[model samples]
Target: MSTEPIDGAALLDEVEAFHRRFNVFPTEAAYVAVTLWDAHAHLLDCFDSTPRLAFLSPEPGSGKTRALEIVEILVPQPMMAVNASAAALFRAASGAEGRPTILFDEIDTVFGPKAGDNEELRGFLNAGHRRSGVTYRCVGDGATQNVVAFPSYCAVAMGGLGHLPDTILTRSVIIRMRRRARNEKVEPFRARVHEKQGHALRDRLARWTEAARPLVDGVFPEMPEGVTDRPADVWEPLIAVADAAGGAWPARARAACLELVNASKTDDKGSIGIRLLTDLRDHVLNGIDRLPTVAILERLHSLDEAPWADMGGKPLDARGLSKLLRQYVTADNEPVAARNIKTGGGVLKGYYAADLSDAWARYCPPPPESPLLPLPPLPASSQP
Candidate 1:
């Protein structure tokens, strides 16, 4: 191996250029931007602790698989698998040289209606992110049988038609892919034609990694303030890799981390069930003992951008509202009880705050604590 320094900026540009030549992924700047760090991840000693890259789409022919193909070209010891059993993956991930960077395609099928068949493989994918992640399985015949510890640490890039399991998605840096538009254009990938150039880039990547590994292993790049917990663990390696790469990569990497992480949060909040509970607790039920359906619906519909207004093919009704609230109740037929809450017309069905308090605490983040003392009304001059 040559001892000369590598041009980190040039190498990063090459990664971005190669990725763009084949596809235009939705949320491209949020996700595709950091894939360069993923490519050269082997340079970091704790690359095993890095998160997996998930390429997800609502439909096929959206360039998801093609992007994984590109990753296979860029990553080290690439193991491209359209389908493989847990046993096969476990054994392959073992042996002398070390973990193979797994490039998995058609990952959605693994969790289809017959998901029971692939739980083992799913477990493997989830556990493979950290160094301590391992699967214990018996090997050899009856007399020789012994439980062997299979190593499950390696970089992974997966492409599929829909979302992965929540556990797996949380551990991944997801790239949402979409069909190309009329104005977009890209080079059609043919393995025979492109593998040569890909191999050349891969070799240079390997050389740079070999020379920079020690330096990268010793450095811990500063994380952005909003990033912490699992988000911090997942983005740390990418940031470190970017820091090693130098130039505009550090800025681009941090921006992608914040953007993608926030996007994931938005996606979670967009779920109807989550929004219902959060809105109920924060806007409708806070400090109140109970609220009738009419009052609840009024408050729900008034909240900005809430889904209740158009839920169930029209405005949310008593039955639909009851059905939604039942998820938090956890008992058969114990939904929003039909208590007669006082109203102008007379009495109507409503929900008691005690019933919802448990669900709110279990599912939602604790609301910001109310101030101990109410501030005096603002002066007329100061009020906007």
Candidate 2:
């Protein structure tokens, strides 16, 4: 190792390079965010909150575990919490030795179908985001039992098979991992050989963070436009670290923040009601004014990638769809309801386009631009 002091920007560059050597992230933004996260773990005391770094994928062999393993070596007091009980996690994080940087692999098993209720564990993950966050627990037995508060503030990174609970998801920097293509290649990580190199980088990060503490503590870095609310909280520390690092990092960090934040909005797998409204706007409505109940159900069920075909273990019928949309209102403040429409043979119950306009605008993004929209007719003055 060099005897000289560490350069923050150059050290971050080295950390990014180290990750690239062993892991293939889905986007350039993903790599940038991960790099900043690794650096921020060393200086958790300087910030008010620590965003959980989540690596999630739909299928197996997408490198979720490898990402956590790589992070395990680079953080302070790394603790792997797979299958750990809630009480165990609380004790480990609140220990006097130091708050462990919790690395949770196979996290899906904690929240999956087979797993029993894990409300306490979930609460721990949620509350730990803020510096003052804590969990209240009753300890002792009989007359001695008393409630106590345990500090839940700690840096956590998780790798899981599917989505996290909404409470945890809002506080996380979500990386949607994908399987590598045939053309993409990465170095095989061998803990025995590569861990030493990772540790060296980790030590350098520690030194840099020590030097940066005075500059970053209580400093709120300027956020990119449109990044507000929970997202602003989640990205604040990472952006502050980037700003302190100087060089091209401040700009790069802001860009990464914008890209990843916007991507999360578009990629959110929202509630079923919201999904139904979105699907109707994008797939069923088109340019037509109204769709009969039967016709609407047909289009929704035919979608191969949608859950309408098997929602609640059966196809979503008109009654269910009506119940879902009943909560939403029209422009006139009337609950969205099915009205009768006259057809060639008889009057049929269906939804009108005007009634759904408000819900579509409020609950979903504007429909994608379609090429099939007809062009305006030639103006009268210009007509030949």
> Among these predicted structures, which one has the highest lDDT?
2
**Deviation in Å, model 1, residue 145 alpha carbon:** 3.3
lDDT by residue (tens digit), candidate 2, 262-351: 888888846778889998888888678998999999999998789899975899999998999999999999999999989998999999
Model 2 TM-score, all chains together: 0.85
Q: Give the per-residue lDDT digits (tens) of candidate 1, residues 1-384.
A: 667788876787787777778768776564434465555556635454768888888888888888888878887888988777878787778768777888889988787544534779878887777867888898899899998889877777888887777778888887888899999899989999888888788888887767668656756679877898788877878887777778888888888888888788766563466678888888899889888887888898888877778764688888878877776663333554547778788787888787777777767755767879888999999999
Going through the candidates in the order shown, the clash numbers are 0, 0
Where is model 1 more than 4 Å wrong at Cα? 1-3, 28-34, 113-117, 269-276, 279-288, 291-384
User: How far does residue 63 in candidate 2 sit from its true spot (Å)?
Assistant: 2.0
User: lDDT of each structure?
Assistant: 0.76, 0.91
Number of backbone clashes in candidate 1: 0
Candidates in order: C-alpha RMSD to true structure: 6.1, 3.4
